[model samples]
Target: MRFLPFTLFLFSSYSLVKAGTLNKGDSCNIGDNRLQAGTYQFWSECNSQTYCGSSGKCETRGCRKDDFPFGYAPDDKLPEKCPKGQFCPDEEDQCQQIQPVGSDCQLNRDDQCEGPPNFKELADTSGRGLNVNGSVCLNSKCMWANATLGVACIVENTPYTAYGVDGEFIDIVSRGNCQLGLYCDAAQKVCMAEKLFGEACTADKECSSWNCLGSGVCGVSESIPHHFAIWVYIVVGLGIFGGMFGTLFGLYWTHRKQRDEEREKRMQYWREQNAFHQNLLAMRETARASILSLPGNGNSSARSTLYSRDGAFSDDVSAPILPNAAPKVSGLRHYLADDGSSEFDDGLMMQSGKKVDGRF
Candidate 1:
């Protein structure tokens, strides 16, 4: 049972170490492989009040504000303000007496110079912990911020480093030694106002518009408008609607015209057919009347007997004669005596004789 407690303690310690909550002098792995310039390389991370040193061990941190601000440090290790008459150095891990104006200092390392006494108080009250006091390290020397428009200034072309709470560098950037809203001119070597539109510019910072066109001129922002004018929308809508309507109407008109033409052709054809039928009926009637008006035979009774009640020839009648009929003389009859017989009667007798011969 006593060994059980010891085992539990060892397990707990092992779990704590595995959790990565390291302490001073504990071995750790560095965060990344690429080490930045002008910054310290630390192993993993250490607990509050300590930082990983070059020897790969945790060492006590010197100044809090210079290395780790309130939010940059661990939650429980919020940094405090630097002591009076002392300032933090960028390269060292200790606080030193503040440097007076005109003293030798490193560029972009403003922490080494003296600033407004109330800067800390203002930062705490304003909720923005920025070192924006008049003092700044410019051109490798401590100086008060005085780079106004038309004033001589130095343009630092080299990049400067910024450190994280663990004294590890995080960012590197180049900002010329000029006051706010001013930029150092590379050619004139003086601070100048930001350029207006259409002015020649080489960089975005040189223009108040923050836009440097490819033609090397300060120009308007290049943002494309996503919304069109109401009139444009209306015009486009009308155009589409008109196009559809015109297409439909054109098709309808064409179809209607075709149908009308077809109907007209059909009607005209029907009229022609009707007229032809009517003319044919009239011709038939005239033909019937002409046939009825012809001279009748002298033997009316005989002619009447040849036709039936329906005005057609009777089946019993073999031959019928007209009223204007004349006897035809045969040439052979000149050689013989005149028979005194009508041609019609002779033709009937001959036909009757032929019938009798056929039967025999």
Candidate 2:
């Protein structure tokens, strides 16, 4: 249980780190150089000063710039904040106050005042009213639109704010409100058919859900939910533990089987030893009986007399005979021939019961 918390913590940290990294299909900001998916890490080919964005697209714009005046490194300093009450506009990079709706304005230069195409005087009814194409300058507000999809429009009853041409809401909170199979067209300011991720785009508004990266291709964000990461960690841990347990169990079974075989072998050896001992005892008893049946008492001479002079058991032959009438030869052979036998024969008889003399 103590190890459980540690294990969970380790896996949880891994999951959080993994979730923070981008997957192959996940979206990314323009400045990020590293994208991670599963166990793989992908490095963006973006230039040194540029980075991938949250829109999953690379961007040269909005890149951090060196604040040499503040003695900061290149691309390290943050953007300056605007003064209170005045909002900073992205196009001008400056702070300004809101202007009256239907006011005359230059595109991108006076975003704080909000106006479209600098065509405030060009209207359908009165110059103060809506434009000929249903565009309005109610509050001098204008918005970016994807040219491929929807055009910019204003709500009839509300203040003049940016909306899709199809009448769906389009704002920071209600982004693109496009219908099924449609995408918000920032260029055309309308909802249009969706494009694939890698399609060429002039701006982030053209991609289906991904942003047009600095490399000119659509990309996704890298962030993921914590629950998903936790689940992945649990699964991986379980798999590893299961594998280890299975290996241990397999080894135990193999050892047990070997022990059983060795036990059986030992039992068989003991059985063989008992049988040999029994046979040896029976042989010993038979020899004792045979000795008891002998004619003389249990003496060494009686045992020796059981065999004749030639080592054959014969009770009829008493002793060897010597013939004195035989001629003796000279030397050692002379003495040996007097015994009625040659030296090679000694005094033994063949199995056919014939006397043998030394001859060719």
Candidate 3:
């Protein structure tokens, strides 16, 4: 499946030129079977030209600089060394065709093929090697992005580095302005981080890998997982908050209602109390007039009669006491109207606090 894409790329390059167009026996000077026209088709994709003659075959691509051998552009030429052990540096000192950009690519620490490339892949891939915090704090686990040394990412480790600090692991490959809480983009050849911890970036100060998009966030594409659980958390938090508010509101309402009821009860009691005092005072006035008119006796004929009112002068002990005490009058005397033309005799007995007529 991977070969299919390569084949397509080659086929497109060779467009007008067919695969294996040259025959083996046709080239007596160079063994033709060793190099077929199909190979010529593969070299043409970058719009590079194929010139084959004797042992010399030059494949040219577009816009290459005067120094390079081959590339996406011409002028960046690369020698047509048909096979392995070929040095093809098309402008990019680290770039080569042996392991094309996408193919079994490898970036070493040194400049040469075996000497220790300046940069290396993240893993010990291509059977090359893994730099475990080499030239840095090796207590923690870490890897290099590429031999270019333009980017690096610090992988946090539980166990402290040999240095004994709780800090981050030192990157094996460090080139860009990376500090704490930052990552480097070896592919794009740029320094990056999620909201840069230390380094400065023109685009995204917080970008971890690529550009810090217009949203202004750095590193991860999403702050929250954008999952059902995220929404659930938000909803649950809101519900809890709302419940608290409602509880407080309900309590306040209940408290207010209770207070209002209590106040009303107090007011009602006061009104009744005030009425009681007023009634007593009026009764005292009436008693005073009655005493003044009395004939020295604490009795009157009308006072003996039973009134229709519910508490009409009853002698019940629980009944309210009169506001004023009646004056005592003697039964040993007769009484006459104001003119002294008539005389009368009568008596009264204080029974159960009410005057009883006496005819003895």
Give each model's whole-structure lDDT. 0.53, 0.41, 0.36
Candidate 1 — worst ten consecutive residues by lDDT sum? 1-10
The residue-by-residue lDDT of candidate 2 on 170-194, one tens digit each, is 2221123233344444345466675
Best by lDDT: 1
Query: What's model 3's lDDT at 131?
Result: 33
Task: Give one clash count per candidate, in the order shown.
Answer: 2, 40, 38
- Rank order (by TM-score, best first): 1, 2, 3
For every candidate in turn, the CA RMSD to the true structure comes to 22.7, 21.7, 24.2
lDDT of 1 by residue, 121-183 (tens): 322122111123656566677765556789898654433233336873323223455665567
The CA root-mean-square deviation of candidate 1, after full C-alpha superposition on the true structure, stands at: 22.7
lDDT of 2: 0.41
Reference-based TM-score of each model: 0.37, 0.26, 0.23
User: Cα deviation in Å at residue 284, candidate 2?
Assistant: 2.4
Q: Which stretches of candidate 3 lie over 4 Å from their true place?
A: 1-226, 229-234, 237-241, 295-360
